[model samples]
Target: MSESPISHLKFSTILSKLRAGINASDLHGSLTGYLCAGGKATEDTWGEALALDFTAEGIQDNPAFPQFFRQTRAQLDDVEFGFVPMLPADAAALETRAEALVDWCRGFLGGVGLAGAGKRGNELSADAREIVKDFATIASSNLDVSGKEEDETALVEVIEFVRVGVLLLHSELAPASSPRPATSPTSRSLH
Candidate 1:
């Protein structure tokens, strides 16, 4: 599989520079989750995803920013009833990879909540509920990958589970129409 544009943008470094509490994966995941729940992600919405109540700066000036943001939005919009977003996770060390995976899952769940998952949490199907619960568990994973072959394999599988799980949650929660309900939450933006 080819890498995402996000593949090279070190999320940890970005968060550090911005002094952001949320990492890139979680921020993007939140945006993806919010959109899947049928919430619009505008510039203001982006601020909410940042979570510290601070505005995301420099994006409008960065030439690559538009494509990156648009690609994420476009993929999440795909419910071909099949497509999954091509997110980034390419750490060199097993331990780092594990951390990134946990960050991704944690972000995804946070995104879901920001999009009003609780309001309709009870509406989730049996399969969906199981998936959501699984993500919560993965978010707190404490693994010692130490270059063990089995551990490496398990990491791959867990990451795959998250990829598919996000799509499942999006599919299950997405509304049926283009029109937003009168009380639906507004947008939450991301990079």
Candidate 2:
């Protein structure tokens, strides 16, 4: 019943204006993934980790992105388990929302990979490994929906699983209290 920490519509509009070539859900997922993998929670570091060229014309100094970045970091660090992926509202079509979830998972996987989480695979607990595996499957699966109530319920369950899984990853991977340096953004391809 609480309002979403970030408004998907407003965030999506900001991305559209910036021509960021990514949806809001995916971007938020990437941010979450990066943070979970111990990346610094700064606009520059996030952009660098994701290889996003914020210096490109209108992308730099965008007021919305910094707010989004801070809000996501706070949600992940919140003790009350408030983290949620930025996806379409429940009023949206089931298929549309599902696709966004898929995109979000993909982005999350990419972010973790970029943050060198793969190198720490041996350190992850069994549950964390399973969570990563499940996220990978979700990211790759072609979810076919019939718009049935059961299908909606299943989607909700999967989303909740993702939310908890991310929290686990963050707790296990992020350093206890170390400051990370911000890397310079490069022109590498995100794919």
Candidate 3:
């Protein structure tokens, strides 16, 4: 797979500096899920949905965060299926990457719920619902594994599944011309 447009370590460092209290993988996952659920791609909408303070000092001035945000949105909107979840580099420990995947899944679930997918359950096609369920299972699963070749293979497969599943969800729920509801602060909270 091609390298993710956003580097996990670099983005994490930026978030830490800004005191965002969220990891890069989780934040990217949430952004993907929010878009998949038809949320607007505006910075304000994203910040509100995630309860992040983009107005925080240095947040707006920092070019990296905004660049990452735009790149993520572009990837999802790309016709070439360029979307990829932000995670540790391949050189990182396998266990660390697995844990990041778990975090990503959890963030995705939260994001979808925040975007009102749960309230629109009947609107979701069977495949979308199944994808959500699978994501939930992955979010809750125990991913610990010894550093074996098979474990590496399995992780890669799971990541691919997640990448495709996100694209499918985006196409189904947020078609390019579809009219999406405005996400207000009140509506952004996950119940």
lDDT for 133 (candidate 3): 81
| Candidates, ranked, lDDT | 2, 3, 1
For 89-150, candidate 1 gives per-residue lDDT tens digits of: 54577787777667777777777787787688789876677777887887776766788889
Runs of candidate 3 with Cα error greater than 4 angstroms are 1-4, 177-191
Q: Which candidate is the best by TM-score?
A: 2
**Best first by TM-score, ranked:** 2, 3, 1
Task: Estimate the TM-score of every prediction.
Answer: 0.74, 0.87, 0.85
Clashes of 3: 0
lDDT per model vs. reference: 0.61, 0.80, 0.78
Tell me each candidate's RMSD, in Å, in order. 7.8, 8.0, 7.4
**Taking the tens digit of each residue's C-alpha lDDT, what string does model 3 give over 51-156?**
6667889887777766776787788777667778999999999999999999999998888777777788788777667777888888988797899999999899
Candidate 2 Cα deviation (angstroms), residue 100:
0.5
Query: How would you encode candidate 2's per-residue C-alpha lDDT over 46-104 as one tens digit per residue?
Result: 78768877776777787777778888888877767777988999999999999999999
lDDT, residue 42, candidate 2: 83
